[model samples]
Target: MTMQSLGDVVGNLVDGIGNERYWRGGKIAEPGVYAGVDIERYHHDPDLFDGFSISSSGLRALLRRPAEYWWSSPYNPSSQEPESKPALDFGKAAHMLLLGEDGFAGQYSLRPATYTDSKGDEKPWNGNATSCKDWLAQQAKAGRTVITETDIAHIRHMADALSRKEAIRLGILNGKIERSIFHKDRDIWLKSRPDVIPISSGDFVDLKTAASVDDETLSRAIFAHGYHVQAGLLRVIVREILGPDAFTSFTFVFVEKAPPYDVRVMQLKDADIDIGERQARQGLKLLRECLRRQEWPGYDGFDQHISYIEMPSWAKTRIDNELNAEAA
Candidate 1:
């Protein structure tokens, strides 16, 4: 046989060694910016990219409940689909109306208030009737989410409220919407899908639907939902894909879902973002270890050690004050 050239031999070796080797069981084989990915595919497709990856929401799950994260991860052999929530569906519909090109009309259909009966008489669609059920099933089969007319009206009002905000309007006008970005951070792969990325200005905006945008309530919600951690992770991914100085700012645009739809815009403080980054790094490290050993521990952790629970400081102070009043 004729001797093969060095280049040919290398090519053969590379072909023999597939991208699977890079996956290392659960890590992504390739990482970079992925643009124009459909939101549904990006969120629902387990094998969208080359291999397993984690988004900001996944990172939040990993931090809060690794077991849940593992159960939901596509990389897991016995992973289960998450149950749908009406609130989440509403949010998605709002996002479609606000961010999607085709709008909610393409992905959602409004359930008629009434349906024609066998006698051609109009009857209220109570959603329990056989015809209504069949109609809903048909909508599902047609890959459309069924929403009430009120939902459509509320979403439209929320969109209208957001439109009046000059800053939000400008950002949406200048930015790319629903772009997915993937980057390998050391051992594990990270993924991010920002709501809006104004490439030239390097400003990013995340849209949120909330019950209240009042300072106190919104502040608590931000911490409770770990929005800061999401902000941190997104900033890192944005900077990694675009140069070091590419990320200029991140803003959260919150809109109330009820009538009179109020809107509020908040920019995260650098200090809070720094804290979020640290927390994100911690979560990533924990994730790497968990994946390496295939051990997913819940909030209680794997230890058999006892956990101590304590009363709140406010409660303790209240009790002390009552005792002093009784003694006096």
Candidate 2:
């Protein structure tokens, strides 16, 4: 018998999920603003519309890598489970705590620093130990996600920092949280879930966790993480669902995860939204064509022609400076 490599094992897992269609039960979600949809259901249920629907994140993937988008989409046959990251996990926990969700104790548990062994001896909790593994399994069976005690404390501090900001506090207090919105535009199904929507005020707010909220870093992050795309998509969805006159402003509330837990609030300008919306529309067009042909292409995309390479601007500048020094 041939032993399967780790890559093969992972590949098989992905194939299994894809074949199962992520077990969404094939129910079609109607296009509208959903107030109480579970976050899990919103993420996993790809048949939310009559056909495959694209979220802001999906659009970003489609724009950057069509093949990646195909595999990451729960509606596609090649879809795979997204890999979890520590930072993402931490951010999720923070969101749950800060978003006015009740019963935090029911959803999350902190791993005890020490556990009593069967022999009645106290030992530090070793994750690799069989007893520790069993303990974690029990937590899972109890329907509680396990997190570090330190993380719990950090989340509390982050929340406190946000509460100190007058605009953030008022915005959240006056808004609905985690609303799922689905709309059809130009024969394409699109979805968005804004973190907070102050309908009365016509202001929308999104929460983001970051390492730094400095101007330069946040500006880079906005483009790098396709936040502009997200903003653009939300604008379209909100306008379609509510009305052109309903949306007055869109803001992002960013909080640091570490010490001091600084907070910053920035609202997108009209020009920024325009740019983001244009990019989103372009991505949707590309996605429509790929879906129709059932052909998701990677960066190379069946192109076999040899391509010439150009030196990077920084490298070229360095070489020129060196040549000038030699002449001097």
Which one wins on TM-score?
2
Q: Mind sharing the TM-score for model 1?
A: 0.81
Candidate 2 lDDT for residue 98:
80
| Prediction-by-prediction clash tally | 0, 1
Pairs that clash in candidate 2: 29-48
**What are the runs in model 2 whose C-alpha is more than 4 Å off?**
1-29, 102-108, 136-145, 301-304, 316-328
TM-score of every candidate relative to the true structure = 0.81, 0.82
Error of 2 at 16 (Å): 40
Predicted structure 2: lDDT: 0.77
Candidate 1 wrong stretches, greater than 4 Å: 1-30, 102-106, 118-120, 140-143, 309-328
Write model 1 residue lDDT over 1-328, tens digit each, in one string: 4545545543432332222122223323565555556666666667765655688888898899799888888778789868768888898888767775554576888899999877888999868777888999999889888889899889889989988998766664355555567788875668887776554455577889988889999899879999999989988886676645556567888899997798988888888888899999999988878878779998886665889999999999999999999999
**CA lDDT, candidate 2, residue 16:** 27
Model 2, TM vs. native: 0.82
Q: Give the true-structure RMSD of model 1.
A: 9.8
Tens-place lDDT digits, model 2, residues 1-328: 3545545533443332233222234454456666556666667676556766888988998888798888877877667867767788788889878887656787778899998788989999888877899989998789677889899889889989998998765655455565667788867778887776553455567888999989999999988988988988888887676655445567888999998899988887878888999999999988888878888888865464778789999999999999999999
